[model samples]
Target: MMVRSLIDIFSAKAFEIDPLHFQDDDIHMKQALVLKQVKHVLHKLISEDPLESLYMVDIIQRLGIEHHFEEEIEAALQKQHTYLTDFSSNHKLYEVALPFRLLRQRGHYVRAEVFDCLKCNQREFTEKYGEDVKGLLALYEATQLGVEGEDSLAVAGYLSYKLLHAWLTRHKEHHQAMYVANTLQHPLHHGLSRFNDRSIFLSDFKIKNEWKCLEELAEINSCIVRFMNQNEIIQVYEWWKDLGLAKEGEFGRYEPLKWYMWPMACFTDPSFSNQRIELTKSISLVYIIDDIFDVYSTLDQLTLFTHAIRRWELVGTEQLPDFMRTCATAVYDITEDFASKIHQKHGLNPIHTLKKSWVRLLNAFLEEAHWLNSGELPKAQEYLNNGIVSTGVHVVLIHAFFLLADTVTKETIAILDDIPDIIHSVAKILRLSDDLEGAKSKDQNGLDGSYLDCYMNEHQQVSAEDAQSHAAQLISNEWKRLNLQILTPNPFSSSFLIFASMLQEWYL
Candidate 1:
């Protein structure tokens, strides 16, 4: 069907359709007619054919569910209002979109195909005609999305599109990318993009996101699995499996689910363990030296689906599956080792109540993930929603906080309570550092902000520099602030201090 073919031609340039450029309404009418016909073809297949069994199902979902939403159309309409000012052509699209959504929701599978058809045609229209003739096509595309948090979808789609476009330009393979980067095509991550292309084109650049590292990790995993003792991988897996992680199909196939398996994936990889693997690798020291990137992650720029444990504890975990628990404990042990090394040398007692608090934190993270996965959290404010802080990677934050706290309600489990407060402080500093990093990148022309900014801005003294990168002195000052908060600073806590110390070096 033309719907699938049109999938190869889509993105921002296609959806911003303008109608005033054409004086005759007939043109708009004709465009609408073609879209309707294309919809008819798609409707036949979706309604009557065995499309679910086909790989094209991915493509169909993208076009139907991801791209076409009522709010998507509204946002596009707002953009259109700016250009057309008083144009009614875009209204034609809304008329088409409502019925499309209803059909799809009702499981009128074949009729729903019309929406996908409209999206494909509109994408083609935008590519060919720009904003001038995109009217019904743009509406058709936008209306396929959900009304709730419609703006987020736009933001994410735009950002992904921008990065993917970058990767495509770098590789100079526009045609193949056309389909691979087609946002209207559904299964957003399944497609290729500028991020993928750029990372591949410049593999040597220390990347700032998990996905960026994914391809490398995969290669690393294969090598690690091949060379290392399967027994070693199996050992960790068995331990985790026994502890309630490492089982397949436990995670429900989303962001949290992905992170639940990350540590294991890394461990299973032989290449990843080799320090020579690139620069450093004590696979056991999963300090996830790399994910430090999460401190300032953002969806529009870049987002790390993992975080936490690096701070103090996991967010919500009421339903945190055993698989995630196993995953969390294993990785926390690895990362905490480094933190403990720092803590011991400095005379600070790293939070040792992980065993006691694991249940509480894991429960919180499970709830957080469930909420996030279910879309209960509105803004994804990690501090506010806890779940916002990297649903799965709470393993990292909880562990980090475990090493940082002075004391918690020792009444029940000594030192465990201090963790929540310590996590806030750490999350605050990290947020500042990240915000600076993000703002700095925006200044430099292609960097995404980190999680650190949000917290830093919430409390504490935040100083904005003309230069986006964090100043060494300022970061030190923040650390000193923390030190002042605690009278007996851990004299041995210099390594994690390494994280703060390296701010200037990493970003500047």
Candidate 2:
């Protein structure tokens, strides 16, 4: 039935289709046709030469349409993986680095040793590659996937950064300078590709004519996605209004749109609309609860609320203040709703686990409250350990795991229960990054001592600027571990890992 509709749309006279007067059904049909056309191009590219296939895959991914051709991409990468050893020393830096980054992005292990041939006698990249802007960009992007102890990648990263900055300085007015500038700030490996502006790529005159179909598909798909996301924002806004937590003036800033952007950025596809909506709700509650701990509630009230959450019962929450009770009830109902849905759909009961995650989060919040109430500051590592959970990344991801996981096994559940390395890495990165920003603004001093504060407290000689620089380095190191985690074997599903990584990327 869908195929027939698409065929009809395709067979319709081109002149009769009016872009200015598209009905809802016409818009959907046109989108489906464009998607189909792009898939055809994808297949054609896959069957072409390996380099062209790699380029198309990169473009499709950068355009955020890779989800539509997962199997084909896997096959293409598999075919390309066999030829990894075939790259001679004569191959250009761009040729070697592009495949390396693509393979690592897909969780296929490629050794950093492949770039050893590109190094000169001083064990640094040659200055001649500096003129090859594309190669320099590719090398820089590949270095982003470097794991700890990869000294060669570190050197390559430094060299590429210098060259890319020089190139950008000389060609500040060039069409590609914006691309270089954006890449320098947000490396491809650390970016959420789906959230990128598609119009930039669409407007690029340098795109090859053979890939015009893919570009058109990306533009049309972006329009459809934008419309869908707007509708979702409306629906989510309605839900927030109905929840009424925002009515309480004391609840910190009630920016539902800002709260919604995190999940929307992480899950860009329209199919994840439910996850986006529910996660947005959870995030709203997280902010409100955070405010309660940080701004509104007294120590006595927070202690009562924390106990009430740990109990997970309505009978005992009446002793809490009005806003505290409202927040607690909302948290309970939302988790119960999520658990009920998971049980109905996946036949697994997650109430205990879900509630436990919230309890842990509240405990972390309370711990910070205690620190804030007292004049003493925690040690650096001690603060980071608690700040990890207090950042709320774990709670968000825990809720997301059940909502998004296709199959809930004992093994996966156990991994989630134990807090896998990927989740920890993401949470740590967010905690540190948030601290770094808070340090700059000086806003985190009274609310919760940031990692920077703790580090300074420990090392009295370090300047504030130096502490922030060290914190930034710590975030970079965590990214390396995260890259290794994502690229190596793990119990978590690919979707879950991508969601986790993308959440941290959004924070960055």
Top-TM-score candidate index? 2
Pairs with backbone N, CA or C atoms under 3 Å apart (clashes), candidate 2: none
Question: On a 0 to 100 scale, what is the lDDT of residue 60 in model 1?
Answer: 27
List TM-score per model, in order. Answer: 0.26, 0.91
lDDT of 1 at 42: 39
For residues 95-159, what per-residue lDDT tens digits would candidate 2 score against the true structure?
88999999988899988888887766432454567678889989999999899989888888888
Residue 3 in candidate 2, Cα distance off native in Å: 40
210-248 in candidate 1: lDDT tens per residue?
223223323332232333333333444443344332243
Best by lDDT: 2
